[model samples]
Target: MSFNEIKQHSKARFKCESNELASIREYVRLKGLSLGLSEEEAFKVSLAVDEACSNLVKHAKKRSLSENGFYICLKIYSDQNQFIVEILDKSQPFNPNSVPSPDMQEYFKQFKRGGLGIHIMRSLIDDIAYFPAKIDKDYNVLQLKKLIA
Candidate 1:
């Protein structure tokens, strides 16, 4: 079925586990395609989601020795021209502006090896916005927006 057939919001909670990162990538890619995104666009969207989830898995510590207590949610919503993916993480309140974006020219010149997940994720999508958790809200949200072409 086409994405418009559903029209309702699409959302999923990706288990913050290393092994599940692949699943998250596939889910996002297929969903993007179903939403009529071009193949290249779908791949880019998936890559961005994968990078975000990979970072989450890399830093996720087992809370309370139980695996069932953790999940980073991915909520998808769309407008006429935009598909938005919002990732909700419970770890810390983050301000995306606080981190300096690396210069691609300088980074390539230096042959940087790691620590570019955020940069990559930012590049793949059309827009990104961060909303830190409020007193009532326990989880901070990272929103990735891909414009449907």
Candidate 2:
């Protein structure tokens, strides 16, 4: 089902920070459990969501106290026995697929420190897509999903 189908179940606009990571992780875990996911599946989804949020914090702009910190929006829905999580971040526009595969041999190369985020994100989720926000002020959207079974 689309996000609108369960929009009411979604929680939007969470603070983004190294310290706030745990809360986001727990949030994902709790949401997954509500969808009938086992502990293991929920933990996996939590870790994946954490990794995605970490990437946003590391690469996105830092917010002052006067401004809202990075935004982490989550939507929960089940596809048959599988659970899907959508995370939207107010960071720079990034397309995970657009990044090239990392080269192990060149990993130590200081200038080649790219694509690792995309790689980790890709490994954790079953499906991912990037969509530009229409508001022209919101961050690029990154959608992630996983199967519970």
Computed on alpha carbons, the lDDT of every model, listed in order, comes to: 0.76, 0.71
The ten-residue window of minimal lDDT in model 1 covers 60-69
Candidate 2 residue-wise lDDT, 59-137, digit = tens: 6664322245366777666755467777776555666668776776778765665557677767777888778555664
Per residue, candidate 1 scores C-alpha lDDT tens digits across 1-149 of 44445253688887788888888888788888887788999899989888877776766553212354368888777766767677887765655546788988999999988779888888898987888877888777787889899
Model 2, residue 142: distance off in Å is 1.3
Query: Which candidate leads in lDDT?
Result: 1
* TM-score per candidate, chains pooled: 0.82, 0.76
Clashes of 2: 0
